[model samples]
Target: MQTFTSYDGTTIAYRVWEAPADAPTVVLHHGFASSATGNWVVTGVVDALTAAGRRVVAIDARGHGDSQKHHDPAYYGEDAMARDLVGLFDLLGLDRVDLVGYSMGGVVALVTAAAGRRVRRLVVGGIGASAAEQGGVDRNSLVGAALIEALLTDDPSSISDERALGFRMFAEATGADRKSLAAQARASRHTPIGLARIKVPALVLAGVDDWLATRPHVLSSALPDGRCKVLAGDHLTVVRNPEFAAAIVAFLAD
Candidate 1:
């Protein structure tokens, strides 16, 4: 529940779980419509990382979670989101750190990491480059909008239960704004040029059942220095899976 000011003077929110002083710091960026607490803390991912002696910094991206919400769709671009990360690091006085991003956050990490040398190691889960290549028009475009509309019904309880508790949590945390959420999705839908510029060690993880980031299409050619891991489950379930977390830890440790 800490806050920092971005370059644009937007008050960004982040939660830090400190481990041993010597442990490597890892930053977690949640997907669209997800907050640090809902996506990582509530799911026990932040706790797991801290218990394993890693300092975890999880952020609530602009227009989502507890961060400042600019209704302007223009502020949701990948470079803009990436600048937020850079602003966070600058605000915290961090030189370099490992980064783990899911969904839209993954695209931000990719663009950020590609643009500079600040990331030590990177793990991208539940998304791929195609979503970026497609200019952010993934299945979520249809599904997310539908889900948002469902939330505005007389009783959102039915819609909340459809994707298990995770979707419900996401819907509640985002305030169920379809236009702003979709704008964020659209903002993340394009890949930045120059993949070969990114020289950092990277791991790209995609869920086998994730329709948004299909295996053969997105993972294969995403990063110039990227390694791929295909796990079992859909996008939501994959982030919390113990095996998936372990893989991320192992990659960062290497």
Candidate 2:
């Protein structure tokens, strides 16, 4: 329940779990419409990393989770969100850190890592570089946004039962308004910039059945030193798969 002030004076909240002072630090960014706890902590990802002797820093991005939310849609841009991470590192006195970002958080990680050498290593799952190169608004993002709007309006019948349930789970975890979340998703979405600048080791992972980020798009040649791996399930389930965690642990350890 620790809080740090972003550059714009917005209070950002993060939970820190550690094994020792010298343990490698891994900062996790949850997906769009999800909080740090719901997306990772409750999923046992943070616990796994901690048990493996890695320090974990999980943050609730602005307008998501326990952090302060702004009504301005412009504030949700990826560059601004990436800047918030840089501010968090400065506030905590961390020189550099490894990053694990899922879904929308993956976009922020790509932006942050591309900005400079702040990241030691990066693992991006449940997302791809298509949005980063294709101006962010893809068919999937548009569909995802429309579904969120329907849920926010309490029109559950507008979406499939399973899809509605998924949105409900995310809503409960992040406390983000459906319309606002969708607007943010549309606004913050963009292609990854400064890709040629990233020199750190990177692992780009996607679920075999993930509708949001498909296989060929994620495995494209744009990413510098980027490597891709496919997991066994869809978005949410793949994040918790044993093989997924093993891949991350092995990459970070290397």
Which candidate comes out best when scored by lDDT?
2
Give the per-residue Cα lDDT of candidate 1 at 196: 67
**Candidate 1: stretches off by over 4 Å:** 21-23, 129-132, 135-170, 173-179, 191-193, 216-220
lDDT of 1 at 127: 69
lDDT of 2 by residue, 1-254 (tens): 98888888878899998668474589998887888987787777887787778988989888877888776677677677788899888877778899998877887888888886779998888876564566342445436555556546665555654654576656755567665565565576555476667778888888888876775244334567778888887877888787877888788878
Q: Candidate 1, overall lDDT?
A: 0.72
Q: Which sections of candidate 2 miss by over 4 Å?
A: 21-23, 135-141, 144-148, 159-169, 172-175, 216-220
- Candidate 1: count the clashes: 3
Q: 134-214 in candidate 1: lDDT tens per residue?
A: 534255434555544453455565554354235445666557554556566545545444566777888888888876566
Each candidate's TM vs. the true structure? 0.83, 0.88
